[model samples]
Target chain A: MATIADVARLAGVSKSTVSRALSRPEMLLPETVATVQDAAEKLGYVANSAARFLAGGRTGVIALVVPTLDNSFFAPIIGGAQARADAEGRQVTVAVHSFAAGESLTTFGRLARQVDGFIIVAPGGSDDIVRAAATKPAVLVDREIEGMSSAVADTASAFTLVVEHFARTGRRRLVYVGGPGNSWQDAQRTAAVRAAAERVGVSLEVVGPFPPTFAAGAEAARQVRELRPDAVIPYATALGLGIQHVYLVAGETPPVVSSERAIVEALGLAGVPAIDVDGRVLGDVAARLLSQRIQDPSGDPNRVRLSVPVTWGA
Target chain B: MATIADVARLAGVSKSTVSRALSRPEMLLPETVATVQDAAEKLGYVANSAARFLAGGRTGVIALVVPTLDNSFFAPIIGGAQARADAEGRQVTVAVHSFAAGESLTTFGRLARQVDGFIIVAPGGSDDIVRAAATKPAVLVDREIEGMSSAVADTASAFTLVVEHFARTGRRRLVYVGGPGNSWQDAQRTAAVRAAAERVGVSLEVVGPFPPTFAAGAEAARQVRELRPDAVIPYATALGLGIQHVYLVAGETPPVVSSERAIVEALGLAGVPAIDVDGRVLGDVAARLLSQRIQDPSGDPNRVRLSVPVTWGA
Candidate 1:
C-alpha cells in the first residue's frame, strides 16, 4: 500500500522526479536513481506496471510466443530466451498460442498491448498472419517475413549434407519425412533435400505432412515401411524417435538421420547420424534480435542464419 | 485505437455498462453482453489490462512458475496448465525461477502484483522460500507446504510397489538414486523405499543427491556400478535414461525402475519397469486448484494426491 508520494517524500524529490527516476533512470543521475530506488525498496513501493504502460512507458517485459510445448524442441528455446532476457534485465512471459488462422490476429492484438514486444516461434504461421501480428516489434524464429527480423537455423543446408552422406553410404533409395505441412522450415528443408537428391542421382520420395510428435511418427513409419527406403530423414527429432522405435521393435535398422543432437544422444541413438541444431543458440539469437528491434524499431530489419553441423555416427 | 466510449455509443450503452459487459459478463443479461461484445468487436476495441488493474479489476492472467525447462518433464505440465487456463478463459504466463534461497522472495513479490495467482513447481525450494512466495494465491506441485493448496503425485507409495516388485523378483540388493537434495519428493521417495526394503529384508543402499538430468545420471551410474545392486530405482526418468545408457554401453542390463512412463516410452525403454506419472493430469489438477483459490481466497486449502500406477515391465 506504499504510494509514489511517500517514496518521493522519503527520497526528498518531486513527484515527476520520482516517476522519471523509476521509468527512465538513464536520463537522471545515478546517485538520484539510487536514492529513489533505496527509498522505494524501504517502503516496498512497487511501481504499477499497468500505470506505466498507460503513460507510454516501457513494461520491461518481453513475450515469447510459441505454437505449443508438446514438442520438446521448444523447451530449450524457451530456456535460452529466458536466460538472455534475464541478462538484459527483462522478464520473459511465455505464451503458448497455436496461431490458428482466425484467432491469431485477436490474440496478437491483445498480447501486443501487454508486453514491450515479442519473440514469435510460429513455423507454420502464414505470411498474412505475420503481417497482421507485426503491429508490434517481433522477431520470428525458423521463419522469415518480408519486412521483419528473423533468426533461422540453416537446416536447409544441413539437409544437403545428409543427402550426400546417404549417397556416399550406398543408400540409393531415400525417403524424407516432412513435418507440419504449413511449416516454412519444412518447405525449405524439403526443397533443399530435393535439389541435393537430384544432384546426387539418387531415387528420392517424400512422405507425410504429419505432426512433429512421436505418435504421428509411428504412423509415418508404417507408410515408410511399405516404401522401403534404404535411408530415412525425419524433419523433427520426435518423428525420428518414433520411426526408430517402430523399426527397432521389428528388429530392423534402416539408416535414420535426425537434426536434433541432444535428443538423439539422450535416447541412446549413438549409431544414428544427426545434425546438431542447438535450439538454445537459436533462441538466444532471436532474443538478441528482438531486443535490438525493440530499442530501434525503425532500423533495417536484420536476418541471422546459424550453421548446423552434421555428425556421421558410428 | 477504439475506446470504451466509442463502443458504448455504438452499442447505445453507458461506459460503465461497457466495462461490466467485458469484465464481469456474468453479472449482465446475456443479450446485453452480446450486444456490447459485438459492438466492441466491430470497433476493434481491446481493453487495456493495465488500466483494468488500476481500476481494481481482475487481470484474467495466471502465472505458472517452474524451476527450469531443462528437464523434459516440465513441458507437458506447462502444456496441460495452458490448456486448462484456456478453458477457464484465462491466459497463462510462464515464469522460470531457480527458487534460490534469497532471490525467490523478491521474484515472487514482483510477479505477485501482475497475475491473479500462481501454479508453482519448485521441488528443490525451501519452506521459507515457499512461505515468502505465498503472498499471492498459489498451488504447489510435487511439494506440500502446510496451510496451502497442493497437487502431488503419490510417488512415495509407488516406491513401495517398486521395492515389493524387487523382492518378488528375487533381487536381493537394491540401490535408490535420489534427485535434488532439498526436494521434498526425493525425501518422501527415499524414506518409502528404505521402509519397504527393511520389511522385505533386502539389502539396500542409497546414493546421489544428483540433478535430474541425463549427464548427472551417468555420473551416478559410475557410483552405482561400485555399489553393484541388482535393482536400481532412479528418482527421475532422465536419470534412469542416463543410467540405462551407461550400463547398456558396458553390456550390462541391470533392472532400472522409474516413475515417469512418458519419457521412458519415448526413449524406447519398454523393458524398464516404470510407474506411470501423467504430468498433464498433475498440471490440470494444480491449475484447477489455483483457479478455485483465486475465486475463493478465504476457503480452506485443499491437498489432492494423485495415485501412481506401477508397470512391472519385461
Candidate 2:
C-alpha cells in the first residue's frame, strides 16, 4: 500500500516530517507541506482517519436533543440548531426523547460522553439523565430543565406581545389558543395570556392547552368558531400552520399552509403576512449560551429571554 | 476533578481497567465495568471528553450532505438519516450546497478531516471532492458521484409506480412537472413519464424544468392551467407540495408532493395516492456499500444499483 512513507521518500523529507505535514500541516514549512501533498496526490494516498484521530483528540462532534418532533414546533428549532452548528464548523447529532421519560434517560446515558456537548430541546428522561446534563456543558431552550443554563423566550413577555397585537388592531374578543396541557410551556404561555387579558381588559378566552400538534390545531379551529374571537393566536408556527389550514379551506383570510389542517404547505409556499420570530435567531442565541457554559462550567450562567412583537399583515 | 484513579480504587480495578471499561467498553467484564461506573457516578466524576478521546480514536461524528431543505423532499431524507444515526449511536452533521458548485467544493474541503465519514445526498462539487470521497469511507444516497460507493433508487420504477396510479384513477391527460431546467433527477423522471405515456397511449404534457421550489411550483400552476392535464406529476416531493398548495387555495386538484418531483417523501405525508419509498433503507444500503469498499480500497470497485418498488398511497 502506498502510504505517507511513500510520499515522504518522494518529497525528500523525514518520516516524522511527513507525519507532521500530513497530520499537522500548519506546523510544517509551506514548500515541504506542498511537496508532500503533491507526492501523496500522485500516489493516491489518503490519510488513515482513525490513526490520525487517535494521535489527536479532535472528534469534531456536537449533539442536539429534542424530546419529540411529531409535533413540528421543533422543526424551526431543529433548523435553527443545524444552522448554528454549521456556522461553528461543527456537525450535530440530533436525538429525540419520544416524550417518554425512560427512553431519554437510557439514550443519554449511552450518549453523554460521545459528543463535545449537547443542545437539549426538552429533555425527557428519568432523574438519572436529567442530573447527568448538569455535569456536562448543557444548555436548555424552550423547555426548562433544572441546573442547566437556558435561552428561552420569556413567554410572559411573548403573551403580552400577542395580546397587544390584538388590542392595537382594535380586536376586543381576543382568544388565546393554548397548547397541550402536559407541557410546562403550555402552562407558562396560558398563564401569561390570562395575565395579559387582565391588563388589556379583553375577553381572552383560553381555548386550550390542547395537544401541541397540527391535528389538534385544526380541532382548536372548531373551538374558535364557537367562541367567535375577533383574533386567534396560536403559540408556535406549526400550530399556526394547522389553524391556518382550517381557516383557508373554510375560505378565511391570509391563504397559506393551513386550510386542510395544513394545505398551504402542499404548495411550494411561504405564509402570507406570517409572524416569523426566526428560529435561527433562537438557535444562534442558544449556541452562544451553550458554548459559554462549555468553556466555563463553574461560572453562574446568564439566561437570555426575548420575544418579538407581533403585527397584522397588510 | 475526581479522576479515573479514584474510580479504579473504588471499583478494585487498575486505572487501565477503568479506562478500558469506558473506551472500547466491549473489552471489559460486565461486573467489573459496573463497579467502575457505580463509583464514578457516586463521585459525580464526569469523564473528561478530551482525556478519554485519546484512546477512543474518532469523535463518533457522521456528516450528512444534502442539496437543501428548502424543499419538503429533503426534510424526510434528513429525518431518515437522523433515525438511522440515532439507532447506531452516532451523531450527524449536515451541510447544504446552495446550488453553488464552487462553494460546495470549499465546504467539503473544510469538512473532510473534521468528520468521521460523509454521507452525501445529491453531491454538488468539484471533481477533487468526488475523488476524495472515492478513496475515503463515504456513502452516497439518492444521487451518485462517479467514484464513491452510492445507494440509488430506480427513478424509472418510481415513475412507473406514479404513472400506474394516475392511469388507474382514470386520469387520461397527464403532465410531468420537473425541477429547474438542469436537474438530473427531474430529467430522469420526465423521461420515465414520457416512456410511460407512449406505452399507455395517454396524452402527456411536460410543464416544467423550473427551479424545484414552492414558489416555482405555484408559478408552474399557471402553465398547468393552460395545458389542463387531469394528472400532474412533478419530479419529487418539493414541487408536489407546491402544486397541492396552489390547487387548495385556488380550488383545483393540481397535484401531490410526489408528483414525480420528490416521490419518496410525497407518499409519506399528505399521502395523496403517491408512491412511498423509504430513504433509510437506501442509507443502510449505502453504509454497507461504503464499509465494504473501505475494507479493501484497491479491490476492483463496481457501481452498485438497487431499486425498491414503491407502494401507491392514498
Candidate 3:
C-alpha cells in the first residue's frame, strides 16, 4: 500500500505537499493535485482514516452490542445510537452477544480492536471483563458497571408510574413480572415495583425474574391467573405480551407500564391503556453518552438516568 | 503498512518463506518461523487480513447486513447467525438500514468493505448494486434477487397456512396486513394471501405495505372495523400486536397470523390461535448459505428456500 512518502516521492514533492494537495486541494496548484492523485492511485494507497480523524470531530464507527434484538425494549435504544452515529457520519456496527453462542466474551474481546467505541447493553460480563472492555471507548446501556460511563432510564420512577396507573384504575392487588434476575433493568424494575406498591398502599406480588421471551410471558400469565392480581404489569415489553394475553383471555382489564412504544401503539388500537416510555429518547441519550467517552477516553465514566411517560388512548 | 516483501527483506528470507512462516507455521522450520516472527514484530508487519484470508480459511469475523434490526422479524435470524458465527470462532458486524432515514444503501455500501463476508437480509438494491454486493461472497436472507444466492422461507406456504388456520376457525371475512411493500417478502406474502383466500372461497381485504410498526397494525385494525373483517392477519409481530389489540378492545376475537414467534407466544397465553413461521430456522439456513459462498466464491451461486409451519404455541 502507498504511504505518504511514496506518493510524495512519485509526485516529486515533500510528504507535506502531498498531504496538502489531497486534504487542501484548493490551496495547491492544479498540477500538484493531479500528480498526487495519480501517484496515490498507482501505489494503491488509501489514507489511514484514524490518523486523519485525529484532527476532526469524529466519524469512525462504534460497535453497539446488545443481548438480543428480539426485545422491543432494546431496539429503540439501538436505533437511537444508529441515528446519532449516522448524523456524525460514524457508522454503527451491531454485534449481538445472543448470537455468539458460548463464545461471546472472546468475540467481544476481538471487536475491541475494530471499533472506535462501544455501546454495551447489559453486558453479561464480569467486573474484570467489563474493565478490560472499558480500555476502549464505551458506554453502558441499562447497566452501570463500577467504572464505565452509563445511560439508563430511572426504573424507580418507571415503577412508580405503573403503581400510580394501577391505583387510578382501581387495582389494589397488582402483580409485577420482572425480567431475568441478572439484568440490571430487571433488578431496578423489581426494586421499583416492590417499593412503589408499598408506597401506594397496594398489594403487589413479584412473580418473576423470568427469561425475557414470549414463552416466559405465557408462563408468567399462568402465574398471573393463579395470583389473581387485579392487573399485571410486566417490567418490560417482552414479558408484557404474555401478561396481557392472560388478562385478555380472562375478560379482564390489565394495564401495563413499559418502555415499549411499539407495544403501546399496538395496545392503543385495542383500547388497552398503558404507561409508555419514550425509548427512542433514551436511545438518543445513550448515543450521546457513548460519543462523549469515545471523544475523551480519560474522562471519569458518568451514570445518567432520564425518563419520559406516554399515556396514550387512556 | 508493512508488506510481505518488507517482512521477507527484514527476516533475511524470501517472500514465499515469510508467507509459509505466518500462515502455515507448522510446516516451516523452527528457525525460519522465529526469524519471521521477530522480523514482523520489528517492522510492525501485521499480515493484511484480506490477503491472509485468501491464503487461509479464517478471518475470525463474519459480517451481516439487514434492512433494519429494529424490525423484530429479523431478530431470530440474526440471533441464529450470531450464535453460529460465534461457535465458528467468528464475531459479527451488522449494518442496519434505516429506511426512514434513507441510510441503508449508503450504510451497506460502506460496511461491505470492512468485513470478511456479508450476510444480506434482502438483495435490496437495483441489479447493478446487487451485482456489486455479489462480488463479495454473500448469502441473502428471505429474499431472492435475480443474481444472488439466498436462503428463503416458504412465505407462500406460510401464508397459505395462515389462511387455512383462519378458515378452520369458521371465519370467512379476513384482512391481511402486509409487510414493507418494497421488500420481496411483502410482495410474496400479499400474493399468497390473495391466492390462498381465493382457493378457500374466502373474502379477504389487504391493507398496507405500511412501516411494519404497531401503529401501522393499529391503523389497519381501525380500517378493519370499516371493512367488517372477521379476522386480522398481520405480516409481523409488531403488526400482530396492533390488530390483536383492536379486536380485544372490541371484545371480539380476530385470529392473528404472523411470523413473529413472540406474538404467537402472547396469543397462546391469551388462547388466540396463531400461525408462526420459525425465524430461527430461516436464519440458520441463511448462515449456512453465506458460509458456503465465502468458502467457495468461484462456485455458482445457489438459492435455497426453507419453510416449516409453526404449530402455534411451541
Candidate 4:
C-alpha cells in the first residue's frame, strides 16, 4: 500500500528519483539508488507498472499473441513462454487473437503500444499481416518471414524420418492428412512429406485441409480409408488420434504417424510413431529471442530452428 | 497510428476532451462526444491503453491467473475467459502463478496495479493464500471463500449420478481417486461420493492426493487395483484415462467414471461414463463476475454454481 511518495520521503529524494532508482539505476549514483531501495524495501513498495511505463518508457511486460487454445499444441508453448518471461523479470500478457486478416491488425496495433515487445505464434497469418503487426519488436514462433526473428520446430526434417520409416517397413502407398490451409507449419509439413515420399519412390496421396480437430481428423480418416494407403501421416496429433479411433472402431490396425509425443503417450496409444516436437522448448526459445530483440531492436534478426526427434513406436 | 493531438485538432477540441470522449463519454456533452468520435473514426486513431490508464484508473484489461497449464482442464477455462473478454472489448492477460503460500502474494500485488481485476482459477491454493492474493477485485473459480465472488462447476452433485449408476449396476465396492490436496472441488466431490456411498449401502475406499496428471492417475490405478474395487471414480479425466490405460494393459476391464466428457471422447475411450462439466462456461461466468465486481467493488459477492450433466456412455 506504500506509494512512491512514501519511498521518496523516506529516502529524502524526489519521486522521479525514486522511480529512476528502481527502474534505471545506472542513471543515478549508487549511494542514492541504495538509499531509495532500502526505503522501498522497508515500506514493501511494489512499483506500479503503468506509472513505470510513463516514467521509463518500458512497461516490463511482454505480449504473447496466439491464434487459439482449442488445440492441445498451444498450451505448452504458452507455459514455456510464461516460464521464460518470469525468469527474465517480465510479465506476459497473452492475447488470443484470431489473426484472420484484418481482425489481428487492430489487436496488434493496440497491444503494441502497451507492451515492450511481442512473441507472436501466428502460423495462420499471412506475411503481410505478420509484417504489419510488427510495429513493435517481435519474435515469430513456428512461422518465418523475411527479416523477422523466428523460432521454429523443424518438423519438416523430422517428417523425412517418418517417410524413411514407412519405406523401411515396405509401405509402398502412403496418405498424408493435411491441417489448416493458412497454416505455415502445415504447408511446410506437406511439402516435406511430398519430397520425402518422392525420394523413397512411394506413391503418396495428400488429403483435405482439415481444421486439425478430432472430428475433422475422423472425417479425414473416412477419406483415407477409401484410399486404403499402406500408411498414414497426419500434420497434427489430434488429427492422428481421431484417425486412429476410426481405424480401431473398424477393427483395422493401420499405421498412424503424428507430430507430437506427449499426447500420444498421454492417450496410451501404443506403438504410434511420432515426430516429437517439444512445443515448450519452441516457446522458450521464442521468448528468449523476443527478449533479445527487445534489448536490441536494430540487431540482426535471429532465426532458431529446434531439431525434432522421431520416436518410432514399438 | 493517429495520435490524440491529431484527433483533437480535427475535432476542434482539446486533447483532454478527446481522451474523455473516447474513454468516459458520459462526462462530456453529447454533441462534443459525437464530434470527437466522428473525427477519431475518420483518422483511424487507436487509444493507447497505457495513456488511457493514466487518464482513467481503469486499464481495460483483465488478468486471468491459473495455477498451471500442465492439465487439460485449465485450457478450456482460459479459452472461454478470453472469448468472453474479447466480446466485452477487454483484453485478457493470463498469468500462471504457482499459489504455493507466499509466492502468489507478490504476483497478486504486482498484477493488482496493472489490471482492472482478476479471474483466478487456483483450486490448489489454500483459503488463506487465496484471500491474501486477492488485493484487487477477484473472482475465484472452483473455490468458495467467505465474502469472495466465485464461479464453481457443480461436479459434486454430478458425482451422485455416478454413484447411483454404479449402485443400479449392482456394484458393491468403489474406489475414488482424488486430485490435489488443496483443491476445494476435489474435497467437495469426495464428500459427495462418501455420502452417496453411505446412502446406497456400498463400501468405498479413497486413495491418493495425486497431482491430477496422467502419471499420477496411473499410480492411483495401481493402488486401486490392490484394493480390488468394483468401480472407480476419478476426480479428473486425465486421472481416469491413466487408470483406464493400466487396466487395459493388464487385460482387465474396469468401469471408470470421469469428470469430463470431451477428453474421454477425444481420447477415444468408449463406454466410459463421465460427468460433463463445461469449463468454458465456468470461466465465462467467472470473468463476467469479475467484470461486475470491478464495476462495483463494494457490492455483495456473487457465488455461481454451474450444473454438471452426467453422460452414461454405452
- Interface CA RMSD of each prediction in angstroms: 4.8, 7.0, 6.0, 4.8
User: Candidate 1 lDDT, tens digit per residue, B141-164?
Assistant: 999999999999998999998898
Highest TM-score model number:
4
Compute the lDDT of residue A47 as modeled in candidate 3. Answer: 28
Which of the two, 2 or 3, has more DockQ?
Answer: 3
Chain A of candidate 4 scores what in TM-score? 0.84
lDDT digits (tens) for residues A1-314 of candidate 2: 46667878898988888666655565667677778767766775532433333244333346677765444455566667776666554566666554454442433654565555777776334444555654457777766655667777665565676676566657788677776555656668778878887888888787776665445666667777677666676765545545654665666553221112122333434322234455566767787777777667788866777675443332
**Residue A101 miss distance in model 2 (angstroms):** 1.6
Fnat of candidate 1: 0.30
lDDT of 1: 0.78
Deviation of model 3 at B60, angstroms: 7.1
Q: Give me the displacement of residue A7 in model 2, in angstroms.
A: 16
Error of 2 at A179 (Å): 4.4
Q: Which pairs, if any, clash in model 4?
A: none
Candidate 4 C-alpha lDDT tens digits along B238-264: 577567656655666656555466555
Whole-model Cα lDDT of every candidate shown, in order:
0.78, 0.60, 0.67, 0.78
lDDT of 3 by residue, A1-314 (tens): 35789889988999988767654555677777778877876775542333234224332557888877767567677678876765554556676764222342434543553457888885355555566655478888777777788887776676677677777777888887877766677777778878888887999888877887655776778777788766777766657765665567667775543435555554443333455665667777778888888777899888987774645343
lDDT (0-100) at residue B46 of candidate 1? Answer: 43
Q: Weakest 10 consecutive residues, lDDT, candidate 1 chain A? A: A104-113
Query: For candidate 4, what is the total of clashing residue pairs?
Result: 0
